[model samples]
Target: MSSSDIFIGETIGTAILILLGGGVCAAVTLKASKARNAGWLAIAFGWGFAVMTAVYIAGPLSGAHLNPAVTVALAVKDGDWSNVPTYFAGEFLGAMIGAALVWVAYYGQFQAHLTDKEIVGGPGAQSTAAKSVEAQEKGAGPVLGVFSTGPEIRHTVQNLATEIIGTVVLLLAVLTQGLNDAGNGLGVLGGLITALVVVSIGLSLGGPTGYAINPARDLGPRIVHALLPLPNKGGSDWSYAWIPVVGPLIGGALAAGIYNVAFA
Candidate 1:
């Protein structure tokens, strides 16, 4: 594919991916949304559907490598780095755009959720409440989950390991199952199978660090969250940000190495 095609395809595809995926989080987390309290199953399935939809729409144009991890894995597998930067640029840009769209779609719900003194914590908070926010700030803000992933139990080693393992599973599926066809793009059956794989990963491994197997998926929205104007949204949790970015890249490379040795 041409650079323009790859860029536009990834940009549009990843935008849809993050829109629907993050939209689920906002729906379940925000107070006013009807899907509120829909639980983890809803999120897992929602993300799977999002991936399916994005892949089908963008596959023909750019092969729909919407995640940086996927792009890196494909590059490693094909020994082709020519378009990696274009793919990465589109992925991150699309992610930020999609996240902003989510904010726009759920502006009122965000206002309601964040402005609640109970959620934001303030001078009126009990000592325990203040302590709770303090602890959360170290990893993520209350509303940050809507934009990015964070660990449930903050252990650097465990959180990084979880991301790597989840990403390896995802990349393996993509590499072996013809989901992306070695960066050529996604086929219909391959897209569906890949989406199911994502859902499976989420259900089995998402509890730890929300299974951020895609670096752009986590970091792009986190950047948007830091920049966007939201009242009392709390810290962006910069401290825990590096793991999601680094772990997924490592996982992609590792998956590609394994594929080269065994599948190639």
Candidate 2:
């Protein structure tokens, strides 16, 4: 595919991904009436569906690299350093656009359901509100709240480890799926495998820190949450933000290293 085609496909695909992945977060967490806490299963399957749908739509044209780590991994695997900048830029831009749409699509619902007071409380309260809304909406038996970082801000090492492991699994799966195999085109089988990988990561390891396996996925949406005119939004939590970015970069690089040793 041409560079233009790749760019367009990646942008649209990433937009759809964040729309669905983050949309679910909003749907369950933000919407007051119909809100339902999207458990690990929901998050896992939502992302799985996001990947499946995005790949189905854009994989043929752009390889559907909605995640920056995947694009970086592909560049490293092929030894093509020149396009690295362009691909990363494309992925980042796409992720931002996608995240923006997710915020927009769910903004009204989020506002309607959640109070301004709830948003300003902190990330923990904001997340809790989301879970409460989701439970009420779905009429679920009981709301399941998953807390990672507390208000006091302890457990730096644990959070970093969580990010690292999450990113490692994400990149390892991409590498194993032959992202660079021009001859091995991605079909339904490839899509299914990718979906399963995402589900596995969420179920087994997403307990701490909501498994932000993609840097762009977290940072981009967090930016939207800050900039968007949400009534009671708390601080963007920018202080602790570097861990996700740095951890994922290291994890992706490490996964590449391991893949090279085992498969290359």
Candidate 3:
């Protein structure tokens, strides 16, 4: 594909991917929504469906590489580097745009959810009543998870390892499945199978750091979270940010190396 094709395809594809994926998060997390408190199974399946849909729609355009990790892995596997920057630019831009769309879709719910006066107290939370306005400004609210991932336990080592291992599984599956065969993009069947793999990873490995197997998927939305005008949206959790970015890159590179050594 030409540079414009790559850019436009990835931009639209990643935007659709995040719209559905992040839409699911908003559906389940935000109060006043019908799907609120739907649980993890719902989220896993929702994200999987999102992947399948986005891939089918954008497969012919940009190979449906909504995730930066997948783009890097393909480059590594094929020994090509010309389009890496293009893929990343489109992916991040699409992600941020998708996230912004999510906020718009759930504007009312977000207003109600974030402005809630109910006090939140627990381990890692300060003991006090719900100070929604203050919490939003100080970046100490629970709303960040809706837009990005955070460790349940806050252990850097384990969190990073989880993301790395999870991303390795993702990239390895993509490489070994022969999904890259098509001149157009991930085959229709390849898209379905890849989406299933994503669900599997979420079901089995998503407990830690929310299984951020894609760098753009995490950082781009996190950037939106920071910049958006949401009320009481806590800090973007920048401290844990590098783990998602670094771990996935490492995992993708490692997967490529392993594929070259053993599978190629």
lDDT of 3 by residue, 138-199 (tens): 44356777777877777889998999999999989888876555546778788889999999
| Candidate 3 wrongly placed segments (more than 4 Å) | 119-140
Per-residue lDDT of candidate 1, residues 1-264 (tens digit):
789998999999999999999999999988789999999999999999999999999999999989999989988988988899999999999999999999999999999987876677876766645744875658567778999999888899999999999999999998897645545576888899999999999999999999989999999999999999998777888999999999999999999999999989
RMSD in angstroms, all models? Answer: 1.8, 6.3, 3.3
lDDT of 2 by residue, 133-197 (tens): 44434322111111012112237788888878888888888788787478233667887788778
Superior by lDDT: candidate 1 or candidate 2: 1
Clashing pairs in 3: 119-130, 136-232, 139-235
lDDT of 1 at 5: 93
> TM-score: which is higher, 2 or 3?
3
lDDT score for candidate 3 against the true structure: 0.84
Q: How far is 37's C-alpha from truth in model 3 (Å)?
A: 0.6
Against the reference, the lDDT scores of all candidates come to 0.91, 0.65, 0.84
Off by over 4 Å in 2: 33-35, 116-154, 183-185
Q: Could you say which candidate leads in lDDT?
A: 1
User: Which residue pairs come into collision in candidate 2?
Assistant: 29-130, 34-137, 35-133, 35-134, 36-134
lDDT of 2 at 222: 62
Clash totals for all candidate models: 1, 5, 3
